[model samples]
Target: MGLLRLGAAGVVLGLASMPTFGQRASAVQLPTYSYFTVGTSVSVPDRGGAWLDGVDRAGSGVQSFGSARLLGGTRAFGTGRSAAGVGITATIHDFEALEAGLVDRRVRSTNAAPAGNDAWTARLDEARVSRAGRGVPSVAAINAELGLAEQAADQEAAGWLQRGRQAEEAGKPNVAKIYYGMAARRATGSQRREILARIAGLQPSPEAGQDAKTSETRR
Candidate 1:
């Protein structure tokens, strides 16, 4: 669900042609595959009370980033009335709030980075399982399968961080931030500190003393 928030910005860049709904007929003569992906982020705030000094807060807030995708293929059989397909899904999660706590010299949050991948196969027994029999294969079942794939992908923190680095180098800081946030969920010790530093560096800083410059120039 978090990954689904990526919206139009989540488009997969330079992807190869994959099978579309109308291509099933032609797919019988060849292999057919397709893919879908999502990426997004969310914020989590701490409800704990603040310290006496407002400068140092008692609670730490977190920013979570997530990315997920599904790659699937279908094989038609017996005049294309029935088909079997397999899908692999992967997900990544990075928690920036945890990193913030580390940098603040306070262990206020306990969250981890997660990444994972999984695979599932489905068979279409008939062109139409039923006209009103709750649809073919069941939506709930499909969702369950995809959920498993997401879990697997979410367990691979290092992989997601590497992807974040790649995105950053490719001039996609927004995408890189998402990956880094997910990687931060699993980072520890010095590695965690390093990720926090990277996240901080990605943020834009305001121009220094712009108001004073304008005032002096006007005078």
Candidate 2:
């Protein structure tokens, strides 16, 4: 994967990388942001470009967006891809140094239960893990702290969208789907619709495909 300089705004704990594949990612150095920016693996053509994984591939973009909440500030997920310019997104969860850089450095100013807007600042410590998190237990908090009840869902969705797109580019559609699924959960309004559509565009399971064919035959 090329460097993941590209970023979209979101509300979540401090941005940092997460380790994918139970290990740290290569040191390609994705850009740092005060908000969480998920990490992705940077890969090169394996020796002599012979490795199947090294080949660069392109993926489809989101033509639709979420329709949840219906908040005004919510921007279309990738409605204006041309304006945003194509950039890499975090694909795999295997980010390097995440365990050491972020999870290990957590600190809490107080013993509060971590509610309200303050939760949005939980701390990704995000190398996707560098945020020295605010001492909230479990990854589920990343959800509430990301301000789930509020309108920041689109912001959070964008980050996930980028990851799915980048994963697709890396010729990893299954991985992309994982991130896209995550985005789908958080996305609202047009963003959600588009992401769902994008997921549909990907290949379906054999059971689902057979069902579709059966339904078509019945029709």
Candidate 3:
């Protein structure tokens, strides 16, 4: 009878522990941010010729996306690439050091998200020129070469357009007009015209129509 009693106590204890075990497992499974360090790695092939003193490989570019953690930690993920030749090369870098770098980083400080407009503009221009430098290549090849970078630029423009539309919808005509003008400058042709029309329709007056002309001038 005592043994049975002990067995019953053991069963109760095991059942009591189950919730704690589950809670611990749940904590472990929770998503959290991490920091990382990224660097470039290059591979060169020896062609053994005048143009090929060493392996002719392109310099690496750094690109990554990451999030912040609750416990003053950051989680970052990165992918890098460099291609000078015909083959597509890619690298994924993971590290803890990135979190260390952003340990005390603020979310929206003026220093944190400070205007990257100039940088984006320069990058877009570079992509355009780089495409042109390819010497009259087919659109497919040009798109393949410049698409990712150019698309990033367009995405920024699209984001501006969305914000402008939101502002216009909120009846903030002046701010909407400014943002729409900016978006038109960033986008091209149909996209520009579409945003202009939306802005014009929002204000619905000679002044709003004038906004479209302003957008055209900026473009």
Candidate 4:
């Protein structure tokens, strides 16, 4: 299983607080009811292409990203312990070779982005579930519950750009600077350069300068 079993709240409390295996129990495990985690992994073979709850081929993986399955796909699969034993098979086609007409690499090698958004969010949800004492869902199951939609980085930058423009029009240079700065972080190429130029055009507020001077005088 990709996720390790967690406590009722999906948290791993300090083991030092508990007695050793042979010792008597003194401390008790507490549940916080919240689960969260952050990490990444790259499974070289990813042999048994994941099922909903680690089963087998979930019917067919509909290409979620690229043109073909290797590029990425989404599919429905069975869940629960019944299907647990499925998809455990591993072979040559699973790794180290290209399939017939398919141009992409095999199962694991096709991991285009190491810690993609989907995987990361799934891990987070799994962590919560495990901590909540609810059984952890398989990677496939997590995908089944999630949607493919997401705001692209450029789209987010555009929103920030619009906010900055609004602030500028309202005569709030300080506020506009904050929004423009955020826009620059997600903007690319010319858009980023333009944001920086806007930043340069705005002058620091007179009140800000006086505040700095007052602090210096106090020192």
* TM-score for candidate 1: 0.24
**Top TM-score prediction, candidate number:** 3
Model 3, residue 3: distance off in Å is 99
lDDT, residue 209, candidate 3: 41
Query: Of the candidates numbered 1 and 2, which has the greater lDDT value?
Result: 2
RMSD of each: 37.2, 36.1, 30.4, 36.6
Taken over the whole model, the C-alpha lDDT of each candidate is: 0.47, 0.49, 0.52, 0.52
- Candidate 2 per-residue lDDT, tens place, 116-176, comes to 4654465432323443545646788767675656566687789999998998787666667
Candidate 3 per-residue lDDT over residues 1-219, each given as its tens digit: 999999999889667655544442111223433232222222212111111111122333333222223122223333333322122243323233356356646423323433466887666655754546566768998688787866766887899898887876776666676677667766876888898787677643355344333311110
100 Cα displacement, candidate 3 (Å): 30
Displacement of residue 47 (Cα, Å) in model 2 is: 34
Would you give me the overall lDDT of model 3? 0.52
The estimated TM-scores of all candidates read 0.24, 0.27, 0.29, 0.28
Query: Order of candidates by TM-score, top first?
Result: 3, 4, 2, 1
User: lDDT by residue for model 4 over 1-219, one digit each (tens)?
Assistant: 435555522443334323232243233333323222222221212233322112222232221222232313233332222222312233224221235235554433443334656887767655654446676789987775543322466787899899989988876677688788778877777888999999999865564444323311110
Error of 1 at 146 (Å): 28
| Displacement of the residue 49 alpha carbon in candidate 3, Å | 64
| Candidate 3 residue runs with Cα over 4 Å from true position | 1-141, 204-219
